[model samples]
Structures are given as C-alpha cells and as structure tokens.
Target: MRAMDEATVRHVARLARLELTEADVRRFAADMSKITDFVSALREVDVQGAEMTLHPIANRNQWREDEAQPGFKREDAVSNAADSEQNFFKVPPVIE
Candidate 1:
C-alpha cells in the first residue's frame, strides 16, 4: 500500500473542519500510512471458508411493555422560555 501523504492528511483535516499545525499534519501522515500498511497486510490473510458475523459476541434486545406516564404541566414546562404563547415556547422566526 502507498504511504499516506501530507497533502491527503491536510485535505482530510480541511474536510473535517480541523485546524492542524504542520507537526499535526506530518504526524497524521505517518499514522495513516501505518494503518493502511496494516490493512494491506491483513488483505493477504486466508478467509475462503470464514463465516461472516455481525458481532464477535452474541447479543439480544430486551423487550419492554409500553406504558403511559404523567408529565409536567404545560405552564411549568415553558416557565423558562424567553417568549411563549398558548402553552408553547416561542422563538424568533428562523426564515426571513
């Protein structure tokens, strides 16, 4: 596998909105290069008869019954709102 270059690392950082120093770019370039090299090595492993599994360990979801519950009053819920009307929190218009 080709080594990860500084240019690629910088481009990825830009896409992620990261502010990286020159040292960070160089470090990430080396780190990503190692990762790709390891993955390349893994590609050579024999798995012709290996069974695909979603997870290493077995897991199951616990089911629960749905139940109705009482909640806070409307007045109390909106008590901290800067502006409210008709039991609803009001905010500035987002459009226009």
Candidate 2:
C-alpha cells in the first residue's frame, strides 16, 4: 500500500471542517496509513461459498399475550417539561 501524503490529509481535513495543526496532520497520516494497511489485509481473506451471518446466537421473535396494561398518566409524562398546556408537552416551533 502507498503511504498517505500531506495533500490527501489536507483535502480530508477541509472536507471534514477540521482545523488540524502541522503535528496533527502528520499524526493523522500515520494512523490513516495503518488503517489502510489493515483494510488491505482484510481484502486477502477468502470467503468463497460462505453464507452471510447476521448474528452468532440463534434468535426468534418471542410472542407475548396482548392484554390491556396500565401506563403512566398524562400529567406524569409532561411533569419534567419546561412548558406544557392542556395535558400536552410544549416544544419549540420547528418551522418559522
């Protein structure tokens, strides 16, 4: 793998809106190089005829009895809010 250059680092810093110092840029270059090397090594792994696995443990959707359950009161739900009216919590207007 090719070594990470200063131009590439500067370009990335600009895109990420990062204000990196000269020392930070040098350190980041080294770290990014190591990460690239690790990814390159991963590319060498053979996974021919391998089935994709989402989780290691066997899992199934557990069903429960659908019954009416008592829940928290409306007053309790808005108790912690800064502003509330008519049993509803008030929030800042999202649209002008």
Candidate 3:
C-alpha cells in the first residue's frame, strides 16, 4: 500500500474540524504510513483453510442454571440518588 500523503492528512484534518499545523500534518502522515505498511504486510500472510477464531478463550456459552432470585426494592435502588421524586430518580435536564 502506498504511504498516506500530506494532502490526504490535511483533508482528513479538515473533515474532523482540526486545526493542524504543517508539522502536525507531516507527523500524522508518517504515523499513518507506518500503520498502512503494517496492514499491507498482514495482507501477505497465508490464512487459507485457517478457521476464523473470534475469541482467544475457547469456552463456549458456559451458563449456569436459570432460577428465580430475590430482586432489589425500588427504594433501595434509588437510595443513593441526589434527587428523587415520585419514586424515581431525578437527573439534571440534558436537553432544552
């Protein structure tokens, strides 16, 4: 893969609303180039017939027997709230 260029870095910075200096663009381009090289090197690996392994741990769906359990009281659940009204926790308004 070709190394990422200054133009591409500058374009990306603009899209992200970043104010990158020339030095910042050059540094980011160098880092991106190294990442591209690593990915390109990975593409050359032989994985034919290799099963796709999702997780490193081989254990699959080891679950305990489901049973009814005691649940927490409503008051206990909201006991630590800074503000509570009508049996529910009240939080600061987030949206206008």
Candidate 4:
C-alpha cells in the first residue's frame, strides 16, 4: 500500500468541499497513512473457520400479552393542535 501524501490529502479535501491549510494537509496525510497501514495489516489475519453473524449475540424482540384499553376521543386528540379542520388537525399546504 502506498503512503498517503500531502498532494493526495489536498485532492481528497477538494473532493469533500473542504478548504484545508498546509498544516491541515500535513496532519491529515500522516493520519491517513497510519489508517491505511493499520487496514493493510488487518489483511494478514486469518478467519477461515469463523461463523458469519449480523450481531455478536443472539437477540429478539419481546412482546407483552395484547389487551384492549380505553382510547382518547377525536376532540381530545386534536385539541392541542395550532389549527384543526373538522375532527382532524389542519396543517399548512406544502408546494414544490
């Protein structure tokens, strides 16, 4: 893997719409080089027998027993809205 140079860092900054100074370019170049080296080193690790999984531990959603409950009236639901039309809350129209 090639080390990240200041020119590459400057080019990347331009692509990202960033305005970086010479000092920032130097810092970023070194940081990016270190990151690339670390990622390259990771390629040396072997995981041939490892099992693939979405998460490290098994997980599942828990649900409580369903039961009927009292509900709010339509008037109560729309009472706090800034504006309302009939039984529903009214909102400003959006135009594109």
The number of the candidate with the highest lDDT is: 1
Consecutive 10-residue window with the lowest summed lDDT within model 3: 59-68
Q: Which pairs clash inside model 2? A: none
Error of 3 at 20 (Å): 0.7
In model 1, the runs with Cα more than 4 Å from the true position are 14-17, 68-96
Return the candidate ranking by lDDT, descending: 1, 3, 2, 4
**What digit string (tens of lDDT, one per residue) describes model 2 on residues 1-96?**
988888899999999999999999999899999899778986788989988789998899998899978998999998898999998988899899
CA RMSD of all predictions: 6.3, 6.2, 6.6, 8.7
Most accurate candidate by TM-score: 1
| Regions more than 4 Å wrong, model 4 | 45-96
Error of 4 at 42 (Å): 3.1
Query: Which digits, one per residue and each the tens of the lDDT, describe model 3 over residues 1-96?
Result: 898999999999999999999899999999999998888987888999999888898976777779877999889898988999877999999899
Q: What root-mean-square deviation over C-alphas does model 1 reach? A: 6.3
| All candidates: TM-score | 0.53, 0.47, 0.44, 0.45
The per-residue C-alpha lDDT of model 2 at residue 21 equals: 99
**Model 1 reaches what TM-score against the true structure?**
0.53
What overall lDDT, based on C-alpha atoms, would model 4 receive against the true structure? 0.89
lDDT of each: 0.92, 0.91, 0.91, 0.89
Poorly placed runs, candidate 2 (over 4 Å): 47-96
What is the clash count of model 4?
A: 0
